[model samples]
Target: MKNKKFFSAEHKKYLRKTRLNRLLISLGRWSVLLFIIGLWELSAQLALIDPYITSSPSRVAKTIIAWAKDGSLWLHSWTTLYETLIAFAISIGLGSLLAILLYLFTPVRKIFEPYLVVLNSLPKIALGPLLIVWVGAGTKAIVLMGILICIIITTMSMLQSFVAIPQEKILLLKTLGANRFQVLFKLILPHAIPDFISVLKINVGMAWVGTIMGEYLVSQAGLGYLINYGGLVFNLDTVMSGIVVLCILASLMYFSVATLEHYIHKKRNL
Candidate 1:
């Protein structure tokens, strides 16, 4: 009973320390962000920097407020969000499926391995004009661009995870008479969870980049469209506002993945 009590106290102390660390880390992040914003605002106010071109935080906030009041902010945000989510979903789903297929068929993997490498290395932006011409300058083209940017990466990441499974484990499963499908479901898929989470985190940024790039090339409405339009009109504040929103959205996505990772780790510990 005394030993158990001792361990219990130690565990509680460890948990408290962990929580405190996390709290301090979050505070530090916020402090840095606030410091930067405060400095930017001060610089602009002092005329040390040009607010018109550089765009102070206050001006950007006002621009966002105006957009919010006119409902254009929500409209553009939703358009970009919709495209990003679809692209994210497709990248994860189709990429994992392709990875699984490649793992299942060695000959196919060999045949497409070099091609995939080449595609992944190719600058996706170069294909923008062709995509617009082929997909006709619409949301489809935008979503496709996002998918094209991410799917290859997702496929490669997932396939690496699948292939990295220990040979001994596979042999053991086989020695126990486990077939290919059984080995995959019982061991491989489960093993890929952590890797998949990491890939999700990476794809979040890639998805946004692809979507925004598509919008820059051919978009009627989206944050990217707003930024492009604002630039054309010399509305620096509007451009900054769109960029701020994009950064916030991307940060949110990254944090969401981090939360999932934390939850999974906690649950595993439990």
Candidate 2:
């Protein structure tokens, strides 16, 4: 039989209201986007702004369609996406491992902590010249750039999460004769799941920034290359199209993280 006791009428009413609110909010967001696009297009048609410079939505769409027909759209997008994904994965894996090590060893943390801060503060763009010279103008340089941008932030954030775990819990585990590795894997890591997810979300944008910046410096392929080429050749429409595609890509990545978060929450609730 259904659990009638748990299904209160007020709870059902609240759920319906929440769903309706969410729908309205989503509609409002799209409405605002369409309104702005419409205004922009209308202004361009009326000669209120230079469409050549600003690149209206229609022009961007046309540019994208042309790229699609030429079959370069996916090629460029995939190139950037590949670099970003690889960098993202490496940064997460390496950063998390490093963070755990730092948390486990106070001396190591003390020695490297200041350097991490310095590296994070350093403008990654400034290292492009050095990276190019070191790694050459290749995908390796691009991936390295992305890793440099993301790794320190991931390490710091995750280390903080590890440090923030309840001291009492660790003490309890130790008192119960649980080893360091057991405590880390069974307790610390589990508790830090939300922090790890947050790091992934933050790293998504960082990875994109790193990839595009690297592309700007060295890439012959990718959306960043297209944007740079278009700007140099005075093709504002192509530049805007590249930017729109990047925004779409970033949004998709962010939503994927959000979906993972939702799944995790659902599992926890269950």
Candidate 3:
């Protein structure tokens, strides 16, 4: 007890308030979710809408349970998850490398900047057919589609973050006789991290879009294919189940990134 430190009364009060605020925020989120779910189920029970077409929450859940029993859920889930993760990893790796290269070479950056801008603006969906012809109908095409959707944005976003570093900082480092590589490692890379995380959050959605689009075109497996197949047969339950599962998966990936951001923020504050 003697070795322990105690906060002032005001500090203790503030801490209590902070905890209460966090509790309230969590409660609010759950309450809203429950309210929506209750409303949906109630509507379905009353036949407010056609559950056959709209697919009620219970119907979706039942379908999901059915999939779980049959094992297709696991297979399809793994296929989509695997392709997405592969594309995500490659996009981040290749995009960051390209950004660094552009940052290090002014002439090359100047030459390619316009083309990159145009390509980034191009509708990537239009490239789906081209990708099919080039890579054949399969995971290669799907993963490439996913990569194409986000890689340019990643490169541009990261490059801007690096360039956004105040010129004064660069001059200071130069004044200290730091080389370009030293400045990059010590300053630019660290400063760009927050932006990199933001780009990651954005790319999560883009990756899903690309992968799903590819699956729509040629995939034999994955959530995207499941959804497409369901729609073709008017299997509302299956379609809704696939959609719900996709949402859950995407939410998981997004929250994972958010968790990383939170951890980084906490470490920085510490």
Error at 107, model 2, angstroms: 1.0
Tens digits of per-residue lDDT, candidate 3, 97-149, equal: 99999999989999999999999999998999999999999999999999999
lDDT of 1 at 17: 99
Model 2 residue runs over 4 Å out of place are 1-16
What TM-score goes with each of the models?
Answer: 0.92, 0.94, 0.93
Question: Between candidates 2 and 3, which one is better according to TM-score?
Answer: 2
Computed on alpha carbons, the lDDT of every model, listed in order, comes to: 0.94, 0.95, 0.93
| Best by the lDDT measure | 2
lDDT string for model 1 (146-246, tens) is 99999999999999999999999999999999999999998999889999999999999999999999999999999999999999999899899999999
**TM-score of decoy 3:** 0.93
lDDT tens per residue, model 2, 2-36: 87569789988998999999999999999999999
Q: Which of 1 and 2 is ahead in TM-score?
A: 2
Angstrom error at residue 90, model 3: 0.6
Off by over 4 Å in 1: 1-24
